[model samples]
Target: MALQISSDCISCGACEPECPNTAIYSGGTEFEYFGKKFEALASDIFYIVPEKCTECIGFHEESQCAAVCPVDACIPDPEFPEDRSQLLAKKVHLHGS
Candidate 1:
């Protein structure tokens, strides 16, 4: 499943750089990917894009953003449940390898 940013986020910006898929984004900051432009998150909180998230497969043993988040703000996205094989597929799609 795609990882998500929870309300517990302190907005410290720690997880942003750790994301390989660039799925983490600062609040109110626009980001473009997959040929689309997504409006920045409205809240002054960290956010994660489910479409771009791969649960760190093919990159790490676990989600790097979640691993480094000081407040434990990053968590599994319940809305987008995915298995390991699916995540691996996404990883290949993102990195083309």
Candidate 2:
């Protein structure tokens, strides 16, 4: 499943560098995906892009960003509960052959 950032985020920016897919970004920062850009959630907190997130399947044993987050701000996104296969598929789609 795609992981999400909760409001508990402290805007520490700790999870940003740990992300493999570059899915995590500073809040209020603009990010591009599928040829479209969206505004971030908060001007102070960090955020994650679900479409670009693959739960670190192809890159790590676990979500590195979540692992390194200090306050456990990163958590499973119930809105995007994907299984292992689905995550792997998303990884492939993001990187391509």
Specify the highest-TM-score model's number: 1
Give the range of the ten consecutive residues with the poorest summed lDDT in model 2. Answer: 34-43
lDDT of each: 0.87, 0.86
TM-score, candidate 1, is: 0.92
Candidate 2: C-alpha lDDT: 0.86
lDDT of 1 by residue, 1-97 (tens): 9988888889999899998899989999887687789798546898998878998888888899989999998988889989999988888887788
Per-model TM values vs. the true structure: 0.92, 0.90
For candidate 2, what's the RMSD?
1.4
Report the CA-based lDDT of candidate 1 relative to the real structure: 0.87
Pairs that clash in candidate 1: none
Candidate 1 regions exceeding 4 Å error are none
Off by over 4 Å in 2: none
lDDT of candidate 2 over 14-53, digit per residue (tens): 8898888889989789987767888875677888899889
